[model samples]
Target: MGGGRSRAALVAKARESIAEGSKSFTVASWLFDKSTRERAHLLYAWCRRCDDIADGQEYGFRDGARDLKLDQASAKDRVEAIRILTHRALDGQPTADLAFDALGLVAAECGITREMCDDVIDGFALDADGWRPRSEGDLMRYCYHVAGAVGVMMAKVMGVPSDATETLDRACDLGLAFQLNNIARDIWDDDAAGRCYIPEEWLVEMDIPPGQLMKPAYREQLVQLAGRLVSIAQVHDMRARVGAGRLKFRQRWAVLSAANIYGAIGKKVHARGEAAWDHRVRIGFLAKMGHIASALKETMRGSYPPQLEPKWTRGQLMAAARMAGPVAGVPNTPLRDEGVRRKED
Candidate 1:
């Protein structure tokens, strides 16, 4: 693959990757301007590739016939491979993999640092270590590493100033909300895979034992917990909306549409309870379109007020981010309110 051809191939591959892997995101991305949409697809390709590599799945679907084992040693090696390739890509070296090259392009265009990439990889490391959350804080920290950090990077890719710490924090909050919804919706599938993300304390309070979450007796308790997760997601989703208001109209519409779509998944999960996992919860195409319409309306109205206190502080979230390393150039400033507010205020 020569220079120009290779770049074109990489971009084509990225578009295919997103279309195959995430229908919701693919649909929402259409709202972005051409340049932003293409770059977002590039970023998504890299992210989807990393996730597939970590889970030993192809586009998130497992080959159940194969004897898939969760060997920590092997997982570590895979993580290392991901890191090496990613670093080479970040260094502007040829990695041969379109996903890595896409990452490099996005990094260069967005000023994304190695530290941000490392933060996302650290989430994979936790999975490799067979980590399970002991408390709400532990779960939220995991969420930050895996999803919130990516949100920050996405915000940067969308041209949010690096110095806009508050807006970035809200972006992180949206990712947190998305992951919480994912955890709630996938509890059964994750347990079947010999993993669980809900806090052990919550399970114990409900009198359920580890690895036995799917037991029929615990359904009610699990529903209550899922509801709690959705409630938290709702709060963060609203705060994220405020942050979205700061972007250009088209970008704002896209962000709000994504938030509504993901938030709808959480709401449906909460509504369905244990039955949510009986069949994977998803927002239908019609429901997604409805959200997109609402997003457009919200963008036009343009009235996002500052939020009340968030459950967690920006300092706490930043500390979690720093667990991987310094967030390159992000200031270590304290957030004014628990929630994100407009910069003008």
Candidate 2:
């Protein structure tokens, strides 16, 4: 198989990866047109693959246990492997991993820069090194590196103009909000894994010792902190809606549906208080269907109320991207030879 045949297989694989890796996203993605939906799946495959590799998990399976031991040397080697594979993929070279090839296809089609992918990889690097945030700003910056960067890439995949900085920043805000929700909901799980995303300063403020978050005595204090985290996520989620308004009808509906699904998770966490971690918070299928229906209504209404001004700026986010490395000078060129010989890193 070659040309269209090969491309179709890659896309099918990517779609399968998304379906198995993230059911919620797979459900929300149905709102996208076929082309955008395929590209989104392709991009998500690369992101998911990178995350799985970094955490030592099997691709497409969240049940795999991660090694809690931090081996800095081994972690650095993995990061290097990700960098080499990603660079080759962006250069239109074949890679051993189909997910990386999908990345190349999406990067070529959507003009995704090396800087954007690097920012995401950097997040994995942080996790591999067992980094812990010391302050709220640090946590937010980590979120930007991981999820916000992915959101920016997704915005590009959605066909947002590269120069549309405001819309792009809002896209980043949405990713940050989604991550905040994850952090709030996964506090116990992360703690069990010897990782903590909650800021050390916040823990100190609550008089809770670092790495002792699950102590029964601090349950109420932790619940209060989770509520605050969800509140912040809500603010950014609303701002993200402002950006969604700028997308096409189908894209807008898809983005809004995703927001509602993830935002609902955070709200449920907040409502459940400390009990949020008693069981992993999940949005049921019926609720997700309802969110999609509501999103469709919002799309038809075609107007979102004004959002509060965001504290984070496009410059700040872009500056972080630049810090990852100089922006690749690759032109937004059309896809070249799709039959490039595969390269192993």
- Give the candidate number with the greatest TM-score: 1
| Tens digits of per-residue lDDT for model 2, 26-122 | 9999899999999999999999888777766666344645456647678667877888899988887778788899899888899899888988887
Whole-model lDDT per candidate: 0.82, 0.82
lDDT of the structure predicted as candidate 1: 0.82
How big is the RMSD of model 2?
A: 9.8
- Give candidate 2 regions above 4 Å deviation: 1-5, 59-66, 320-345
Q: Across residues 120-167, which tens digit of lDDT does each residue of candidate 1 receive?
A: 997887787777777677677778889999999989889998899989
Clashes of 1: 0
RMSD of each: 4.5, 9.8
Span of 10 residues, lowest total lDDT, candidate 1: 328-337
Give the Å error, residue 92, model 2: 1.0
Separate clash counts for every candidate: 0, 0
